[model samples]
Target: MTAISESGPSGFPPGYFLITSTATGRVLDVGGQAIDDGAELILWPSKEVSLVQSRRSPEADNQVFFVDDSGALCSRSSGHAIDIDHDRLVLRHRKPASFAHPFPKFSYHQELGEINVKFDGDPTRNMYILTSVPLRKPKSFIDDASQFLTTNIRTPFASLFGGVDTNSTPEQMTSAGVDLAEDEVLEEERGEEGEIDDSPDEKREIHMLTIPHQRPWNLAEKAKLRRRFEIIPLRTASKRTTGITV
Candidate 1:
């Protein structure tokens, strides 16, 4: 989908959001393809993308990040985000190649055929040729499509694009160790093995702060901690082909 801001920049040529914010909701010009600046972008006959929702909360912007020439919208200098409804729409202005890995929806058609194996001599071909190697039955079209829609076979930005620093050993430890972890009061009084740990909620806020304006939606990262519920982002590598090419 695409939308033009009646109030945002009117001279944007064509490219991805090196910087932008969307708390206000996305707007677009469609470069004048649409009748108005606020015209909504929809699921072109192709269901590969869609605009299921829209809103005009307030005129807000998020931080945007960049590295060399990787054309992707960013909420921070490191990752990405869709923190505002408006920001979602503005992303449409991006060239298809920008978010090529992340389609709003998926669609594909396939046909399976049985092989008529031949002995290479007789009039009738009854069975398929077999190999010593074991083979799995092909999944149905629906199964294949579902896999396309839901499978995330990529490492996260925290590990990619220089997000996480595995080499940076902690100069200070805070969170408690296994011995006193069972007793909350004791752990609180005596700091943990790491630096004095902050509350999870507080840490979440800190994580959000790390986002660039354009990458606001990427604020879902969970700080490295005991097994916790948080958004784990999966980023695809910039490559020509994806998994399971038919």
Candidate 2:
């Protein structure tokens, strides 16, 4: 499912809050914000990245954490509580040994509308707070389409860059996370499906215009893309691949 956002994808439900690092200036983002079990939680830049590329930022369902009745901080995306393994943060299903492990507790600063989390039995270590970050709002189809074209493997190229769906009504486009201008929407709707040539040459031209020629393939960029696209792996990458590929 492609995520859409108006403000940011990191928005949580009313009772939940974003956990940000005081030292890093990054919010706690589930690895790719991918809604999967055992997804690693990491500190990512406060700004919107993959899933919330648009200003109509939908909620970052993966980042939201809940304070369950058991006093354990649980993830909305994975339904697992936050845990520490060998001093590294991770998410895992509760087990018998989980009882001995420290769980997170939440505290609110009502005057500032800020929330913070503290690890069990201690108020100092591994604490995170809530903060706001600004995001770009002037959207472009190229910016988003480029990302979609590069990342979406399920949809074929011809279907993706078919030069807009003339059959779709204004409401349909909006529901599908498209934020085209009123005039553009109407014009596209009225356009004859055959009027725009979808020949091989024309499709290539349209593809070049909507999508970028090249994308960043650095480790950090790929990691972010994986999370945003929800690319699940059957098994973890081998240590050799991890060391050499990156």
Poorest lDDT segment (10 consecutive residues) of candidate 1:
106-115
Q: Candidate 2 at 28: error in angstroms?
A: 0.8
For all candidates in order, the CA lDDT equals: 0.22, 0.41
Q: Write the per-residue lDDT of candidate 2 for residues 77-156, one digit (tens) a residue.
A: 67787765433356767667746565655454433334444555553333343322122233478966764654343233
Mark the regions of model 1 whose C-alpha exceeds 4 Å error after superposition.
1-53, 60-69, 75-246
Cα TM-score per model: 0.15, 0.32
Best prediction by lDDT = 2
lDDT of 2: 0.41
**Clash count per candidate:** 36, 9
Local lDDT at 1 for model 2: 20
